[model samples]
Target: MLMGLLWASAAAAEAPSMPGHPEGPMAISSRSMTVKNLDHRIIFDRDVVVKKGDMDLQADRVEVILTAPPNEAAGHALSALPGAGGAMLAEDNVERIEANGRVKVVQGGKTATADQAVYHNADETIVLTGRPETWEDGYRIQGSRITILLKEQRSVVEESRVVIYPDEGSASGGP
Candidate 1:
Protein backbone atom coordinates (compact mmCIF):
# COMPACT_ATOMS: atom_id res chain seq x y z
CA MET A 1 0.00 0.00 0.00
CA LEU A 2 1.05 3.61 -0.43
CA MET A 3 0.87 4.20 3.28
CA GLY A 4 3.36 1.46 3.92
CA LEU A 5 5.82 2.91 1.47
CA LEU A 6 5.54 6.33 3.01
CA TRP A 7 6.41 4.91 6.38
CA ALA A 8 9.29 2.86 5.08
CA SER A 9 10.68 5.79 3.19
CA ALA A 10 10.63 7.91 6.31
CA ALA A 11 12.77 5.49 8.21
CA ALA A 12 15.31 5.27 5.44
CA ALA A 13 15.54 8.98 4.76
CA GLU A 14 18.53 11.05 5.83
CA ALA A 15 18.64 14.56 7.25
CA PRO A 16 21.25 17.11 6.35
CA SER A 17 22.52 19.88 8.60
CA MET A 18 20.51 23.03 8.33
CA PRO A 19 22.35 26.32 8.31
CA GLY A 20 21.14 29.34 10.28
CA HIS A 21 19.16 26.96 12.43
CA PRO A 22 19.97 26.41 16.05
CA GLU A 23 20.32 22.97 17.54
CA GLY A 24 17.46 23.51 19.93
CA PRO A 25 14.35 21.39 19.98
CA MET A 26 11.63 21.66 17.37
CA ALA A 27 8.11 22.51 18.50
CA ILE A 28 4.95 21.88 16.58
CA SER A 29 1.35 22.77 17.28
CA SER A 30 -1.85 21.99 15.43
CA ARG A 31 -5.55 21.48 15.88
CA SER A 32 -5.00 17.77 15.64
CA MET A 33 -2.03 15.47 15.52
CA THR A 34 -1.61 11.85 14.47
CA VAL A 35 1.58 10.12 15.51
CA LYS A 36 2.54 6.70 14.24
CA ASN A 37 5.71 5.50 15.87
CA LEU A 38 5.69 2.26 13.90
CA ASP A 39 5.53 4.23 10.66
CA HIS A 40 7.95 6.87 11.86
CA ARG A 41 5.62 9.59 10.69
CA ILE A 42 3.63 12.37 12.29
CA ILE A 43 0.82 14.31 10.71
CA PHE A 44 -0.60 17.57 11.94
CA ASP A 45 -3.68 19.11 10.46
CA ARG A 46 -5.64 22.33 10.68
CA ASP A 47 -3.72 25.48 11.44
CA VAL A 48 -0.44 23.68 11.82
CA VAL A 49 2.63 25.57 12.97
CA VAL A 50 6.18 24.32 13.36
CA LYS A 51 8.85 26.33 15.07
CA LYS A 52 12.54 25.72 15.46
CA GLY A 53 15.07 28.36 16.39
CA ASP A 54 14.25 31.62 14.57
CA MET A 55 12.21 29.96 11.83
CA ASP A 56 8.48 29.31 11.80
CA LEU A 57 6.30 27.47 9.30
CA GLN A 58 2.54 27.79 9.17
CA ALA A 59 0.18 25.75 7.10
CA ASP A 60 -3.13 23.97 7.04
CA ARG A 61 -1.42 20.62 7.29
CA VAL A 62 2.06 19.32 7.97
CA GLU A 63 3.62 15.89 7.78
CA VAL A 64 6.92 14.97 9.35
CA ILE A 65 8.77 11.81 8.38
CA LEU A 66 11.46 10.75 10.80
CA THR A 67 14.54 8.69 10.02
CA ALA A 68 15.63 5.67 11.97
CA PRO A 69 18.45 5.94 14.43
CA PRO A 70 21.79 4.41 13.77
CA ASN A 71 22.21 0.69 14.21
CA GLU A 72 23.32 -0.61 17.58
CA ALA A 73 26.86 -1.23 16.37
CA ALA A 74 27.15 2.23 14.90
CA GLY A 75 25.60 3.74 17.97
CA HIS A 76 28.23 2.10 20.12
CA ALA A 77 30.98 3.40 17.90
CA LEU A 78 29.50 6.88 17.87
CA SER A 79 29.12 6.86 21.63
CA ALA A 80 32.85 6.45 21.96
CA LEU A 81 33.44 9.78 20.30
CA PRO A 82 33.63 12.87 22.50
CA GLY A 83 30.40 14.88 22.76
CA ALA A 84 28.67 12.72 20.19
CA GLY A 85 25.82 10.89 21.86
CA GLY A 86 22.97 13.37 22.09
CA ALA A 87 24.00 15.64 19.22
CA MET A 88 24.46 12.78 16.84
CA LEU A 89 21.08 11.42 17.76
CA ALA A 90 19.40 14.62 16.82
CA GLU A 91 21.29 15.02 13.58
CA ASP A 92 20.46 11.53 12.40
CA ASN A 93 16.69 11.89 12.53
CA VAL A 94 13.96 13.89 10.78
CA GLU A 95 14.21 13.05 7.12
CA ARG A 96 11.56 15.11 5.34
CA ILE A 97 8.68 17.49 5.93
CA GLU A 98 5.64 18.43 3.92
CA ALA A 99 3.43 21.45 4.38
CA ASN A 100 0.27 21.97 2.42
CA GLY A 101 -2.44 24.57 1.94
CA ARG A 102 -1.44 28.17 2.36
CA VAL A 103 2.03 27.37 3.56
CA LYS A 104 4.08 30.24 4.85
CA VAL A 105 7.61 30.11 6.13
CA VAL A 106 9.44 32.91 7.87
CA GLN A 107 13.10 32.89 8.80
CA GLY A 108 15.09 35.90 9.89
CA GLY A 109 14.14 38.67 7.43
CA LYS A 110 12.94 36.40 4.65
CA THR A 111 9.45 35.08 4.03
CA ALA A 112 8.04 32.55 1.57
CA THR A 113 4.47 31.69 0.72
CA ALA A 114 3.07 28.86 -1.31
CA ASP A 115 0.21 26.43 -1.55
CA GLN A 116 2.51 23.53 -0.85
CA ALA A 117 6.07 23.10 0.31
CA VAL A 118 8.24 20.02 0.63
CA TYR A 119 11.50 20.07 2.55
CA HIS A 120 14.10 17.35 2.03
CA ASN A 121 16.23 17.27 5.11
CA ALA A 122 18.89 15.14 3.51
CA ASP A 123 19.78 17.83 0.99
CA GLU A 124 18.64 20.89 2.95
CA THR A 125 16.47 21.78 -0.01
CA ILE A 126 12.94 23.15 0.04
CA VAL A 127 10.69 23.05 -2.99
CA LEU A 128 7.72 25.37 -3.13
CA THR A 129 4.93 25.19 -5.66
CA GLY A 130 1.51 26.61 -6.44
CA ARG A 131 1.99 30.34 -6.64
CA PRO A 132 5.27 30.32 -4.82
CA GLU A 133 6.65 33.68 -3.77
CA THR A 134 9.44 34.93 -1.58
CA TRP A 135 10.27 38.34 -0.20
CA GLU A 136 13.41 39.69 1.45
CA ASP A 137 15.48 42.88 1.57
CA GLY A 138 13.26 45.03 -0.63
CA TYR A 139 12.95 42.37 -3.31
CA ARG A 140 10.18 39.96 -4.18
CA ILE A 141 10.25 36.90 -6.39
CA GLN A 142 7.42 34.75 -7.61
CA GLY A 143 7.54 31.73 -9.80
CA SER A 144 5.83 28.54 -10.83
CA ARG A 145 8.28 26.69 -8.66
CA ILE A 146 10.99 27.80 -6.29
CA THR A 147 13.79 25.78 -4.83
CA ILE A 148 15.70 27.04 -1.85
CA LEU A 149 19.05 25.67 -0.73
CA LEU A 150 19.11 26.47 2.90
CA LYS A 151 22.79 26.00 3.67
CA GLU A 152 23.91 27.83 0.56
CA GLN A 153 21.52 30.74 1.09
CA ARG A 154 20.55 30.49 -2.54
CA SER A 155 17.23 30.19 -4.35
CA VAL A 156 16.39 29.06 -7.86
CA VAL A 157 13.12 30.10 -9.37
CA GLU A 158 11.52 28.66 -12.48
CA GLU A 159 9.27 30.75 -14.73
CA SER A 160 9.94 33.60 -12.36
CA ARG A 161 8.98 37.21 -11.92
CA VAL A 162 11.05 39.56 -9.81
CA VAL A 163 10.55 43.02 -8.39
CA ILE A 164 13.11 45.15 -6.63
CA TYR A 165 12.21 48.37 -4.88
CA PRO A 166 14.60 51.30 -4.79
CA ASP A 167 15.48 53.09 -1.58
CA GLU A 168 13.74 56.36 -0.73
CA GLY A 169 16.66 58.64 -1.59
CA SER A 170 17.41 56.80 -4.79
CA ALA A 171 13.78 56.98 -5.89
CA SER A 172 13.76 60.74 -5.48
CA GLY A 173 15.73 61.11 -8.76
CA GLY A 174 17.22 64.45 -7.82
CA PRO A 175 20.82 63.52 -8.70
Candidate 2:
Protein backbone atom coordinates (compact mmCIF):
# COMPACT_ATOMS: atom_id res chain seq x y z
CA MET A 1 0.00 0.00 0.00
CA LEU A 2 2.80 2.45 0.89
CA MET A 3 4.63 1.61 -2.33
CA GLY A 4 1.50 2.23 -4.38
CA LEU A 5 0.98 5.63 -2.80
CA LEU A 6 4.60 6.64 -3.50
CA TRP A 7 4.28 5.79 -7.18
CA ALA A 8 1.08 7.81 -7.48
CA SER A 9 2.67 10.84 -5.87
CA ALA A 10 5.67 10.65 -8.18
CA ALA A 11 3.46 10.43 -11.24
CA ALA A 12 1.42 13.39 -10.11
CA ALA A 13 4.55 15.48 -9.68
CA GLU A 14 5.63 14.73 -13.24
CA ALA A 15 2.91 16.73 -14.92
CA PRO A 16 3.80 19.13 -17.75
CA SER A 17 4.98 22.61 -16.82
CA MET A 18 4.24 26.13 -18.00
CA PRO A 19 6.37 28.77 -19.71
CA GLY A 20 8.55 30.88 -17.41
CA HIS A 21 7.71 28.28 -14.84
CA PRO A 22 9.09 25.10 -16.34
CA GLU A 23 10.33 22.27 -14.17
CA GLY A 24 13.97 23.27 -14.44
CA PRO A 25 13.89 26.92 -15.53
CA MET A 26 14.27 26.49 -19.26
CA ALA A 27 11.94 26.29 -22.24
CA ILE A 28 12.65 25.99 -25.93
CA SER A 29 10.65 26.10 -29.12
CA SER A 30 10.85 26.86 -32.83
CA ARG A 31 7.89 29.24 -32.90
CA SER A 32 7.60 33.00 -32.36
CA MET A 33 6.76 34.97 -29.22
CA THR A 34 5.42 38.34 -28.03
CA VAL A 35 6.97 40.21 -25.11
CA LYS A 36 5.78 43.30 -23.27
CA ASN A 37 7.48 45.69 -20.89
CA LEU A 38 5.22 47.12 -18.21
CA ASP A 39 7.37 50.02 -17.15
CA HIS A 40 7.99 51.52 -20.56
CA ARG A 41 4.73 50.34 -22.07
CA ILE A 42 6.83 48.95 -24.90
CA ILE A 43 5.84 45.85 -26.78
CA PHE A 44 7.98 43.64 -28.96
CA ASP A 45 6.26 41.32 -31.40
CA ARG A 46 8.87 39.41 -33.29
CA ASP A 47 10.75 36.13 -33.38
CA VAL A 48 12.71 35.66 -30.18
CA VAL A 49 14.24 33.02 -27.91
CA VAL A 50 15.45 34.06 -24.48
CA LYS A 51 17.21 32.31 -21.62
CA LYS A 52 17.11 33.53 -18.07
CA GLY A 53 19.68 31.90 -15.84
CA ASP A 54 18.72 28.21 -15.98
CA MET A 55 15.34 28.79 -17.62
CA ASP A 56 14.82 29.09 -21.36
CA LEU A 57 12.04 30.85 -23.29
CA GLN A 58 11.67 30.53 -27.05
CA ALA A 59 9.12 31.47 -29.65
CA ASP A 60 8.76 32.54 -33.24
CA ARG A 61 7.83 36.03 -32.08
CA VAL A 62 8.15 37.97 -28.82
CA GLU A 63 6.75 41.27 -27.51
CA VAL A 64 8.28 42.84 -24.42
CA ILE A 65 10.54 45.42 -22.75
CA LEU A 66 7.89 47.79 -21.43
CA THR A 67 8.96 50.26 -18.75
CA ALA A 68 7.31 51.97 -15.77
CA PRO A 69 8.40 54.18 -12.96
CA PRO A 70 10.53 52.31 -10.48
CA ASN A 71 8.52 51.77 -7.35
CA GLU A 72 11.04 53.68 -5.29
CA ALA A 73 12.83 56.52 -7.04
CA ALA A 74 13.79 57.86 -10.45
CA GLY A 75 17.01 56.18 -11.58
CA HIS A 76 17.17 54.17 -8.39
CA ALA A 77 20.08 51.76 -8.39
CA LEU A 78 19.38 48.03 -8.36
CA SER A 79 20.46 44.96 -10.26
CA ALA A 80 17.78 43.71 -12.65
CA LEU A 81 16.57 40.20 -13.29
CA PRO A 82 17.21 38.96 -16.82
CA GLY A 83 14.00 38.69 -18.84
CA ALA A 84 11.95 39.29 -15.73
CA GLY A 85 9.41 41.99 -16.71
CA GLY A 86 7.95 40.64 -19.94
CA ALA A 87 5.92 37.92 -21.59
CA MET A 88 6.81 35.72 -24.59
CA LEU A 89 4.30 34.16 -26.92
CA ALA A 90 4.53 31.53 -29.62
CA GLU A 91 3.41 31.84 -33.25
CA ASP A 92 4.24 30.78 -36.79
CA ASN A 93 7.57 31.47 -38.53
CA VAL A 94 10.16 31.77 -35.81
CA GLU A 95 10.41 35.55 -35.30
CA ARG A 96 13.93 36.88 -35.12
CA ILE A 97 14.33 39.39 -32.31
CA GLU A 98 17.83 40.58 -33.04
CA ALA A 99 18.49 41.30 -36.71
CA ASN A 100 17.39 41.47 -40.34
CA GLY A 101 14.06 43.25 -39.92
CA ARG A 102 12.33 46.35 -38.65
CA VAL A 103 11.94 46.98 -34.91
CA LYS A 104 9.24 49.37 -33.75
CA VAL A 105 9.22 51.26 -30.44
CA VAL A 106 6.25 53.29 -29.25
CA GLN A 107 6.40 55.81 -26.43
CA GLY A 108 4.03 58.69 -25.77
CA GLY A 109 2.74 59.03 -29.35
CA LYS A 110 6.28 58.57 -30.67
CA THR A 111 7.19 55.66 -32.91
CA ALA A 112 10.64 54.57 -33.97
CA THR A 113 12.10 51.69 -35.93
CA ALA A 114 15.43 50.36 -37.09
CA ASP A 115 17.04 47.36 -38.72
CA GLN A 116 18.57 46.33 -35.41
CA ALA A 117 18.14 47.21 -31.76
CA VAL A 118 19.56 46.34 -28.34
CA TYR A 119 17.73 47.01 -25.11
CA HIS A 120 19.85 47.20 -21.96
CA ASN A 121 17.55 47.34 -18.99
CA ALA A 122 20.38 47.69 -16.52
CA ASP A 123 21.50 50.87 -18.23
CA GLU A 124 17.99 51.90 -19.17
CA THR A 125 18.91 52.66 -22.76
CA ILE A 126 18.21 51.44 -26.26
CA VAL A 127 20.55 51.56 -29.23
CA LEU A 128 19.16 51.46 -32.74
CA THR A 129 21.20 51.24 -35.92
CA GLY A 130 20.71 51.16 -39.65
CA ARG A 131 18.64 54.11 -40.79
CA PRO A 132 16.84 54.65 -37.53
CA GLU A 133 13.73 56.81 -37.50
CA THR A 134 11.78 58.29 -34.62
CA TRP A 135 8.46 60.17 -34.26
CA GLU A 136 7.90 61.68 -30.84
CA ASP A 137 5.60 64.40 -29.57
CA GLY A 138 4.82 65.51 -33.14
CA TYR A 139 8.48 65.52 -34.07
CA ARG A 140 10.11 63.10 -36.47
CA ILE A 141 13.85 62.50 -36.55
CA GLN A 142 15.72 60.19 -38.87
CA GLY A 143 19.40 59.42 -38.99
CA SER A 144 21.89 56.67 -39.67
CA ARG A 145 22.09 55.93 -35.96
CA ILE A 146 19.99 56.65 -32.90
CA THR A 147 20.64 56.22 -29.21
CA ILE A 148 17.80 56.49 -26.74
CA LEU A 149 19.20 57.84 -23.51
CA LEU A 150 16.62 57.15 -20.87
CA LYS A 151 18.93 58.36 -18.17
CA GLU A 152 18.66 61.91 -19.36
CA GLN A 153 15.36 61.34 -21.15
CA ARG A 154 16.52 62.24 -24.68
CA SER A 155 17.22 60.69 -28.04
CA VAL A 156 20.51 61.35 -29.77
CA VAL A 157 20.87 60.83 -33.51
CA GLU A 158 24.25 60.46 -35.15
CA GLU A 159 25.27 60.94 -38.77
CA SER A 160 22.99 62.62 -41.29
CA ARG A 161 20.79 64.83 -39.07
CA VAL A 162 17.70 65.05 -36.83
CA VAL A 163 14.56 66.25 -38.59
CA ILE A 164 11.26 67.04 -36.95
CA TYR A 165 8.15 65.79 -38.73
CA PRO A 166 4.99 67.30 -37.36
CA ASP A 167 1.43 67.49 -38.65
CA GLU A 168 2.00 71.15 -39.34
CA GLY A 169 5.43 72.68 -40.05
CA SER A 170 8.37 71.89 -37.78
CA ALA A 171 7.23 73.13 -34.39
CA SER A 172 10.68 74.21 -33.19
CA GLY A 173 11.08 76.48 -36.27
CA GLY A 174 14.71 75.39 -36.66
CA PRO A 175 14.46 73.74 -40.08
lDDT of 2 at 105: 42
Residues 1-175 of candidate 1: C-alpha lDDT, one tens digit per residue:
0000100001111223224444555667777766566676667788777766667778998877767432332342112223211111233466787889998877665567889888787777678899987655555667788776666645567777765566523221211
- The per-model lDDT (C-alpha) reads 0.58, 0.37
lDDT of 2 by residue, 23-131 (tens): 2221222233322223422233445444433323323333332233222223421223346433322211122223225445432233455666654544544566877
Whole-model lDDT, model 1: 0.58
Any idea how many clashes model 1 has? Answer: 0
User: What local lDDT does model 1 show for residue 70?
Assistant: 29
Q: Lowest-lDDT window of 10 residues in candidate 2? A: 1-10
